[model samples]
Target chain A: MMVTGKKHEAAAAPSGAKLDLSHVSKVFRGGQGVHDISLSLEPEMIHGLIGANGSGKSTLLSLIAGQRFADSGLITYGGDHVNEHAAALSQICLVKTYERSWENYSLKEIFKFASIFYPHWDEQLASELMDKFQLKGSKNYQQLSRGGQSMTGIIKGLASRAPLTLLDEPVIGLDASMREIFYRTLLEDYSNNPRTFVVTTHLIEEAENLFERMVYIKRGRVAFQGPVEDFAANAVYASGPATVLEKLLGDVRVLHSERLGGKLLLALEDLSGPAERRMLQDQGVELSPVPLQKLFVYLTLRDAENSQGGGNR
Target chain B: MSYRSLMKFHLKDYRRGALILLSIFVCVDTALVLLMKFLPAWDMGTADNIFSINRNIMSIFMIISMIVTVAITFPLMSSFSVTRRNFYVSSLLALLAFCITAALAETAVYLIGRAVLPSIGLPVDVDRPILLSAYVFMLTLLDVSVATFLIGACYYRFKVITGTLLAIVYFGAVSLISQMFPSMEYMENFALFSSDPAMLEPGTTLLAWGIIALCAGAGWLIYRRTDIRM
Candidate 1:
């Protein structure tokens, strides 16, 4: 098993335009919360948080948004702790899945109420996005379809223009076309008005182009956090004759391996060294890019396997 | 935004419903008054006058409204990123305003009866406005809001069964305390004892404030640790 990165508190590092969570942990009654998670999100970039279901992605976002307080550790945005500080919390807007609490409110009314708190709420942009999404202003939130509910939340997240915006499953029930539109709208709006956005979604391939960085959370800890290219490059999916692949792989750590039609496919990590590349070339082994979705599955499966092994002991 | 703006937004939810309910209540009360005026020969002796009419019915409805509003508003405000402290402060002020409005409305109804009843030969012999004690009305409203808000906060923090159990125990304890202390009985009869000299005594006020403080403390303790489950 690959060693997980240690969460360190480095003051004066990643200075300015960053949201910092240092050794934050929030444990619920049934032991179903995030643990000792530390992450630093820089501004004006789109970041993706990918993990299996129940892997604490939402919990981390909740802690950052002040929806839940950490059991320990600190979260700071723009140099102010967000747990109880309104000024600091105002910097982030979190858009969650459909909530029945909004049933009594019309979309326009919800916007009117929320605009009061968010200093950078863009009324025109919200109106335009609502119109584009075909979301009726007069309909109560409960009256909308599932995709419409997602649209309302997306509109809020985008229009708030908070320095830090977190969207949890923003496209849960969106159709293919709506999902495409959302991606385009997000990228265009993000470019026009630069701000930080952290999105967690299951459809990684669809949204991978919009992400500059990806954080893979397994169980309650971060398995990986780095640039998207670096994450894709951190592991290689090699396929060739089983004998040649084994020779090429040598001592490289294999996260996942399988045989397909008399050939071997292995997810090899830490294979970026020149020596390993030369060996693979000499053996004529094929190297495929590990997409974010497969990377997430492989990492989470590895974690689950390790956890089960520990439990059996 | 300012606290006043949030208070207005929170209070706005009750506007239409309150208007409709109060309108129906006033219409029915006025119809009753008119019927009494027309039937001058029918003297139902020992009947309570309008100035002394019990408002427990309205108070019960007020208690339910407080609970429902708090239950609904907590999550809604949290979704809007309003802090728990801000919500509590705004709700406190809004509840106070609601109590004052209720008190004034009750007083108006009695004053209207006093003006109309005597001219129609229906005499009110009470020493003062018998059913419109602002102190009693305010205290009762405050207690209802605090107790119901606390129960709603409990529900926000726990599951339905646990929340329901906590709510029953909380309300039962309040009931037990009110029953055990004779002074606390004033919560049910403040208007009845409005003409008594003991109405201004400090004991009831102290007890009422003490309960309010306890409720506030308990509510803050629950709210600070709660996760906003969206």
Candidate 2:
């Protein structure tokens, strides 16, 4: 079956800045970091940075935000080097899950300093979000619950109104209803104020609909980068008899395969075209769409298998 | 503009803590001075020594405050897209302001005590020249502040374990050198300002400034390259 969903429209004329990373790399002493990542992110679009834990997602965001200097290569925003250009750095905001330095500060104090530093900080919006999240400005950050702490970071990211805002696991501790409110507020804000947003989250399915572009990182490399719809369309599951499926999927990269009773369910990547998919369907193979979360799991599992010399299982 | 704003923010953040520290010193010293006045038999020295005692306490306070300020504000400012240069410069300015404030407060307390205690029939002698003492106290506090700021920067850059070890090694080296040259007294002259205004040495003051410059430069190099780990 075809992966049918509401394809996100092309972003409106960009009020935000463009970001480009060319051959960027950062390696830690323990040998884990991003490597040779070259990517171009257009303005005024929501980009999802998806990856497994320790896949350099946070490192990549840090490099982009100038929080961590890249070991090599260049990262530019609005045609200026992010780290070298003070103006460019000022236009970007990156919010992490937890900031140890913030523990002693109250939310009111945080906002006070943020307003001084972020030239375009939206005080009214910050206040409104605080109310919506049911957080007290007088409470120190360390006194908040885990979810409340996440809300504080989220409020900062949203209220900064920077041209490029990067949120790393913004909804980590948010409950279901709070998460829904966050999604709603984010989309509403984007509609009103179009800018570049790069959100890294583990909840792929929940955020899938919000992302216009998806960048998948695997083992410190860019495994895939394209529109979310294209990412979903490129890989799929084809379940049928083992022998028939094998004959049909010749030479194609199988991301995952499992034997269920007498049948085989294979997750295949880069399926050629409609003609190939139809042919598989004609061969008594039931082709179905793969969910974004499932596709991520399958891809990571496939990489793990390949690394262990278990080829195309 | 951002630099000025950051400087202002830091001053605001630190002022309350500075006031609280100053208050604690004033309260404790006031109580001590009162006890000494009422029970002259318990008095160990001239009451005018409060000025020097307060200067010593302020020096220790300056070091602790600088370290805490850097540890707290570096990450906070970095998160706000503050450049390392701006953060460092603004922090230094704030620390200088704090040292100056502390010096003025100490001088005011001493002048007040010298004037009031003698009028109240408590014998108090002027042990040190007031203006010279204030100048010495300010310079001494500044030197300690800069040195402590460098250590704080090192702590953030190298992380907790290595930073703590480095601090221990540094103090150990200083102590060993002081023990080896007990007669020379060079370490004491290098580390502290003379409480007696007549004994104030220009060479010692210049050495303090040189050490401040060295620490500021080295700290900036480390801080500029340091990653803002969340």
Winning candidate number (DockQ): 2
Q: How many residue pairs collide in each prediction?
A: 0, 1
| Candidate 2 lDDT, B100-135, residue by residue in tens | 888888878877877777786777753566676566
Categorize the docking of model 1. Answer: medium
> In candidate 2, which residue pairs clash?
A1-A287
Interface DockQ of each model: 0.56, 0.64
Which candidate number would show the highest lDDT if scored against the true structure?
2
List per-model TM-scores for chain B.
Answer: 0.81, 0.84
Compared with the true structure, what per-residue lDDT tens digits does model 1 show for residues B1-230? 47877877866766755786587667867776777788877553322345344355356656777666666777777777777788777887887788777766776776776777778777766645344365666677677777778878787687678779977887677678768865666565533444454654555678888888898888888887787875
Q: Give Cα distance to truth, residue A172, candidate 1, Å.
A: 1.0
Model 1 per-residue lDDT tens digits across residues A1-313: 1111221111112323788899999887788778899889888799999888888999899889998889999998988888767777767788988766788888988888777777677777788888889998899999898999999999989877777889999999999998988999899877766788999998888888999999988778887898988877867888888887765444436778888877889887667787877777677678877876787677667667767787311
